[model samples]
Target: MNNYLTPNFAFANMIPVHAQGSRVWDQAGKEYVDFSGGIAVNALGHCHPVLVDTLTDQAKKLWHASNIYTTEPAQQLAKLLVDHTFADKVFFANSGAEANEAAFKLARKYAYEHYGAQKNEIIACVNGFHGRTLFTVSVGGQSKYQEGFAPLPEGISHIPYNNIEALKNTINERTCAVVLELVQGESGVLPAQVEFVQAARQLCDQYQSLLVFDEVQTGMGRTGKLFAYEHYGVSPDILSSAKALGAGFPIGAMLTTDKVAPSFGVGSHGSTFGGNPLACAVGCAAFNIINDQKTYENINKQSQALINELNVIGQSTGLFKEVRGKGLLVGCVLTDQYTNQAGEITKIALEQGLMLLQAGGSVLRFAPSLLLTDEDRQEGIKRFEQACQNFLSHY
Candidate 1:
C-alpha cells in the first residue's frame, strides 16, 4: 500500500472510505461523527445533493475551458457573490492561498499605482494566518512559518492583533494595506473586536491604505453571516474567500469594490485553472442554498446549541478554560491543568468515534457543517464527552 505521495501532511492511520451527512466510515467500517467539516470547507456536509448534482451536470457540459473563455457557471457564481457581498467584482483561484496571494498582490499594486513603490508596505496582525504562499506566509505574522523563507517579500510588518493602539502606531502614510482575519481561525478562533475592526477601517481610510479581510475561514456563512465583516458593520476594500464556497469543491475568490478592482488590470493577474466551470457550478449551488434567511437562522441556532453543549462538558469535566467563537466556528481552550494537550484530546476522540481539530496546541477547534442535525450533534457530543473523560482518566 505504498502509494506515491508527498509526506507533507501528518495523516491519520484511519482511511476513510465514504461519508454521508455528518458521518464518515473508515475502510474497516468504523463510523465517526464529523466535527471538523473538512476544516470548514464542507459547509453542506459530505456529498450534499445539490452540490453533487451541480458538479455532475457541469462535468457533463464542460470541465476546463481555461481563462481564455468564460463559462456560464462562472458568470452566475460571480454574480451571486457580487449581489450578496460588498464586492463589485470577483477574481477566482483554486485555493485559499491563491485567493490571498491575489489579494496581497492587488493591495500592493493598488498602492504602487495610486501612490508609489514606497507605499507598498503591508501591515498584518500578529498570529494571523493568511495562506502558505511565500508572499502570504511573509505577510502572515507568525515567525515560525517565515523561518528559512528569506529573502522574503519586503515591506510587510506585523502588529499585535486586536490592539487598536498598536495598529494606530504601526499603520501610517506608507502603508499599502492592513490585512486581518475577522476570526483568527488557526490562532485559536479569536474573533476581532468590533471596535478594533472599526478602528482599522478608520485608520486605513485616514492613511489612504486599503483594508483587506482574509475571510477564507469566516466567509460563506461560517460566522453566522454571509461574511464576517457584515457582523462588524465595516466592509473591507478587498476580501478573500474560499472555504465552503463550493461546498468541498476547490475554489477561491478575491472580491473587491470597483475603486480597487481596476488596479488589477488586464495582463496584470491571471490563473490557468481558475474560474473553471465545474467549480463555479458547484459554487453557485452552494451560494444559493447558504444565502437564505432560514439558513442563517439555522446557523445561529445550531451554533448556540453546540456552544451550550461544549460548556456543559467543560463545566462537568473541568478540562476546558473557555469556549469562544462565532456561529459554527467554535474553539474550546483547555484549562491550565490540561494545557498544550489539544492534539492528545483529538487523538483520543478519534478512538471514540469522534472527529475533532486543534487550534495550535491548546484549543480544540470545531468547525462543523452549518446544516448539522440534532441527531449528529447529540451523537458527536456524546462521543466528545466520553473522549474527554477518557483523556482525563489517562492523563
Candidate 2:
C-alpha cells in the first residue's frame, strides 16, 4: 500500500479497525488488550457509552460556530472545571500543544504587563515534554525535538528536574514563569518529589514568577486523582490539560487563577475550532464521570493491582529493574542486560496480542484506562508475560 500520510511518525504494522472497553481488533480480526489507552487520551476506554451519547447528541444539535459566539456546552464545561479545580478562568484549544502554547504566551504576557519586558525568561525542567509547537518544543528540555526547528523561540532555559538547588539558583526576577510536568511522561515516567514541587512554589512566589503545570499526560484521573497537583498539595498559577479531557475527543484547555487570567485579555489569544459544542459536550461528560470520589478510589485500587503484577513479573523474569509511576500511568524500567530494548519488547508484545508503549528506549510505559476491569487486567498481564518470556528465550 502506498502511504499518503506524512513520514513523521514511525507507523505500527497493525491496523486497528475497532475498539471497545480495553480491547482493540485489527483489520485481520486479531484482538489486542489495549494498555496504551491511545497514549493516555482514552480515559474511559474506547467508545465509552457516555461520551458516545454526548457526542452524538451534540453533533445533532451543533458542530462549530467558531469563537465569535459563546456556546452553552463551552460555558458549562468551563464552569465545571473552575468549580472543581483552582482555576478561575479557562481557555480551550484543539490539542495539548495549543493549550501549552496559550499557557506560555499568557505567562510572558502577564509578566510583561505587570512587571516589565525584561522579565521575559521562562524556566522549564530538563527532560520535560510539553508539546510539539515551536514555542512549546523550545520550552521542552529535549534537544532532539528542537534540532531542525531553529531560530526557535528564545527566553527559555532548562534545569535538572527535581533539583531544588538548581531551580533556586536559576529562577529570579527575570523569570516570567517556571513550567514543569507533575509527572514527566515522555522522557520517562518520573514523578516530581514533593519537596521539589514545594520549593518551586516558594521560589516562584519569591521571584513573582508564575508556576505552570503541564498536566497533559497526568490530568483527568490518570494519576488516581482528578489532577496530579492534588497529590502534591500545591497549586499552580497556570495549568494545561488535555489527553483525557474529552475522553478521546480532540480538545485541550488552559486554566488559571483570576489574578493571572487578566493578562490574557481581549484579543490576546484565540482558537478557531476550540470550545466547540461537540467537544465541550464530550468533555463535560468525561469530567462528570471521572470527578467522582468513587472513581478516584477505584483508580488507586486498580493502580496498585497493576503495580503488584508488574513487580511480580519483574522478579520472576529478571527483565525489569524497577516499576514506577502513579495510578495507571506505569513504567517498567528494563534491567541493564536489556538496555534500550523497550521498543523491541513493545513490538514483541504486539505480536502476542498486547498493546504497549515505550517512554523512550529503556522504559516500557503503560497508560491503561482508569476503569480497567479485573478480567482485562488479568488477560493483559498474561499476554504481556508471554511476550516477555518469548523475548527472553530468544536472548
Candidate 3:
C-alpha cells in the first residue's frame, strides 16, 4: 500500500511483513516460517533475549556520542575481535558495505604507501558482491549493481571464483589487493575451495599484494567458524565483517594485521556513527554468544539438518538439480524447468507462510539463523516443500 518508503524490490508484488524468530506473520496475519533470517543477518533469530538486554542496557546508559570521545563498548568490542581473530587493529562501521569500503581504502593506501601509486589496482572474483559504495561497487565483480551508475572507479579487475589459475594470472605486482569472499553468498552460496583460497594467499604474498577477505556474509559464526578464513587455515592481511556480526543490530568492522595497520591514520578514514556504543554493546553480546564451541556445533548441526531435508525433498520431486554451500549458507539449485520459477516459488512460499531468498538466477537460497532449532528447521523445510508442491501443481 505504501511504496513511498520502499524501493521496488524484485519481489515487490508479493512481499509481506511481520517477522520474529523462525516465523513471521504477514499483513493477513498468516503464519510463515522465516527461513531467510533477513538474508542471514539474524544469527540469533528475531528479538533474541540476550541481544535485547544488551541493546536495552546500552540504550539506557548512552545511545549516541560523537567519535571525538571513545566509548567503552566500542573499545571492548574491538578488543574482543582482535583477541579472537587475526586482526591486530579494528575499525567499526554501520554496515557490510561500509566495512568493505574501509577495507578497500586501507588496501589501496597500504599499497601506495609501501610500494607506490603504480601498485593501486584491485583484483576481485567475478560474481563477488562486495557492497554498493562507489569504490566497493567497482571492486565487486557483478556489473548489475553497477549498472546505470557508471563510469565506475578505475583499476579494478575481476577473475572467476575458484579459478586458481585465473586468480594467479590476474593478481600481479601492480595489484594492490585481491578481494574475495570465502563463500560467495549472493553469487549462490559457493564456497571457494581450500586450495583456491590458500593459493590466493600465496599469490598475494608472491606479488606483495594485500589479501582482503570480504567475510560480510560468512562472519560471526555463520560458517561454523568466527570467520570463514579459519576453516581454510589461511589468514588475510585485512578482513571485512558485517551482517550477523550484530545479530540484526546494524554494525560492521574492518580488521587488519599490524602490517597493514599503519596505513590508516587518524582522519585518514572515519565514520561519524561508526562504532557507536549502542551497536557495539549489542555486537559484543552477539559475538560472545556466537563465538563458542557449542554455538559452532549448533550451526553445523542445524545446517546439515536443513541441507539433508532439502535434498530429500529435491530428490523426491526432482525440482532441484543440485545442493551446495556450507554451515547455514545453502542453495537449492532449481532444474531448468524450475529455474524461472524461483521468484514465483518465493511468492507462493510467502503466501504459504515461509520466507526464503534467491542467490543469482537459478537457485532458492536459504540463510537461516545459525542457532535455529531442529524443530523449526524441519518445519520450515516442510512448509517450503509444500509451497514448491503447490506451485508445481498450479503450473
> Stretches of candidate 3 above 4 Å error?
6-19
Question: Per-prediction TM-score, please?
Answer: 0.99, 0.99, 0.97
What TM-score does prediction 3 earn? 0.97
Which one wins by lDDT: 1 or 2?
Answer: 2
**lDDT: worst 10-residue window of model 1:** 1-10
- For candidate 2, the per-residue lDDT at 191 reads 92
lDDT of 2 by residue, 1-395 (tens): 67899899888899999999999999999999999999999999999998998999999999999999999999999999999999999999989999999999999999999999999999998888999999999999899999987899999989999999999989988999999999999987999999999999999999999999999999999999899999999999999999999989999999999999999878989999989899999999999999998888878988999999999999999999999999989999999999999999999999999999999899999999898999999999999999999999998
lDDT of 3 by residue, 249-290 (tens): 999999999889999988999999999999999999999999
User: Global lDDT of each model?
Assistant: 0.94, 0.95, 0.88
Q: Which ten residues in a row have the lowest lDDT in candidate 2?
A: 1-10
Tens digit of per-residue lDDT, candidate 1, span 1-395? 57578986888768889999899999899999999999999999999988888888888899999888998999999999999889999999999999999999999999999999899889998898988999999988888888987889888899998999999899989999999999999989999999999999999999999999999999999999999999999999999999999889999999999999999998999999999899999999999888888889989999999999999999999999899999999999999998899999999999999989999889999999999999999999999999999999979
Error of 3 at 6 (Å): 5.4
**How well does candidate 2 match the true structure, expressed as C-alpha RMSD?**
0.7
